[model samples]
Target: MSEPTMDHHRWGMVLARPRGLLTAEPFWSETADGIEEGLQHTQILFFLHQVPGLQEELEVYRRWSAQGFVHGVILVNPLVNDPRPALVDQLGLASLHAGVETPAPGSASIVSDNVESTRRVLERLHALGHTRIARVSGPSHLAHTHIRNTVSRQIAQELGISVRIVAGEYSEESGRRATAELLGLPAAGRPTAIIYDNDTMALAGLATASALGMQVPDDVSLVAWDDSASCQLASPPITAIAQDVHAFGRTIAQCVRRIESGESSFEVPEPAHHWLRRASVAEVSPPR
Candidate 1:
């Protein structure tokens, strides 16, 4: 006769955005199971795969949490020291409360260690006889850009190789523009090899080289960081670092579980960077 004692174990959740980078269905289904098992009045899960960026969506999660729509939120891709810190801080200050609130009082992030990954990738290029290499980095404001550029520069300097850098957004168009800029440089000033932050940029760079009547490996070798599907079908089939995106998604879901159990910090093994050797690189010959 007692109103069924509210399931104290129930804790609702709100997920951040599109989870998979390489594939989706597998993680979506696994995450759905987590949601069902956690729905016992102690948990209620609501995912936001359609939301824009981290800060904006965190605010939405706070609103719904305050209205009892969800007890907690499972967010992703919250790059720290972000350009939009003010927005994130403001939302955090507004959401602090008795029980339902931003769990950590700030954005919690789970991301691949991009800097170390890039460093290893650069080392791979160096081993392949790429001495004079250039970098096509992502936008300056993003944390991934900062990490990749820092590692690239540090490694290039240590190896005594000349490195050139061109900045662009993480889009194919940005990659095209950056590539054109590199090609515009005099042949004497240009590096013999180019590395891009993502597969999108690498693929675009290949097109730009073709437009300029240049042959990859013979004219300029190319390497990309993220291993996307398009990277494999390019004329020469780009060499790239293939990440386990399915593992990334599953890790985020697991982080949420730990946070709910009063464990504020969870550590994941840094992703190891591997080079997929293809036809994009060529051996350099001494000048006559």
Candidate 2:
């Protein structure tokens, strides 16, 4: 029997750590849209649901390869001790990794400066006089998350600010829960500024703060990881670290195109990420 050949005009991706509303989530959706735009002619599809573990993801890859369902795959949210790189290579699936700084032996990657960017966020918050801060971060296992954790810790210590970190699953519920827990603490112990992992969670956290009679930026400040239309249209626009998600997606698509065109493996640097200052962040007041 002949081996399965490339599935013409088709490529696949599975959302590694999905936000609650995968379809509605602006960042990923926008990124996917960009990928489509970059692909121009090729049809691209994203597997939106969470696939649980590497074995499952690999299984998906195997089935897809065996059936010739995809020409390649775009992987995001690389895990700590990731084996997908080597595994994908072994399975003969053309792959491109987004959000990876260092890829495995002979694999393609798109790198981002999560460490420096995270440090910059903390530095900005500290500059605003936010002393006691809290971070509602995404899943702990993601490589990006790991980098942020390390950087946040180091920067917080260097700046002499107290930072409490909590894990979330990129859901509104997780944000609400984490925010409530932080706000319920004694005033002296509670964080005055909260940094959320995504816009959805940030919006929920803001509402949670308000429901508890807390005034945004006055009683507490917030900074979201990804900027969104919803974040901007909120009661007070959310302060966010904005990256051109669409451009990043398009870049991913371009890399895949290059790989398919016989460019084996190469590293593509991620686009710039910057802060979107808005009403949600305010300078801390001097104690009475």
Candidate that scores best on lDDT: 2
Q: Write the per-residue lDDT of candidate 1 for residues 10-93, one digit (tens) a residue.
A: 343333333342132233344445445444353535343445455556566556534544434443333435333344244432
Using all chains and alpha carbons, the TM-scores for the candidates as numbered come to 0.73, 0.92
lDDT (Cα, 0-100) at 20 in candidate 2 = 48
Candidate 2 residue-wise lDDT, 1-288, digit = tens: 887776655778876544346754688788888887887765545333357566777788888878887877888889998877777777777888888867666677898888888989999988888889999998888888888888899999999889999898788899999999999999888998999988888999999999999999888999999898898998889999999999998898888888877887688888878989999999986550
Evaluate model 2: give its lDDT: 0.84
- Residue 54 displacement in candidate 2 (angstroms): 4.3
In model 2, state the lDDT of residue 95. Answer: 84
Q: Identify the runs in model 2 with alpha carbons over 4 angstroms from their true place.
A: 1-4, 17-20, 42-54
Q: After superposition, how far is residue 48 of candidate 1 from its true place, in Å?
A: 3.1
Candidate 1: lDDT of 100? Answer: 13
Q: Which runs in model 1 stand beyond 4 Å of their true positions?
A: 1-46, 49-58, 78-80, 83-111
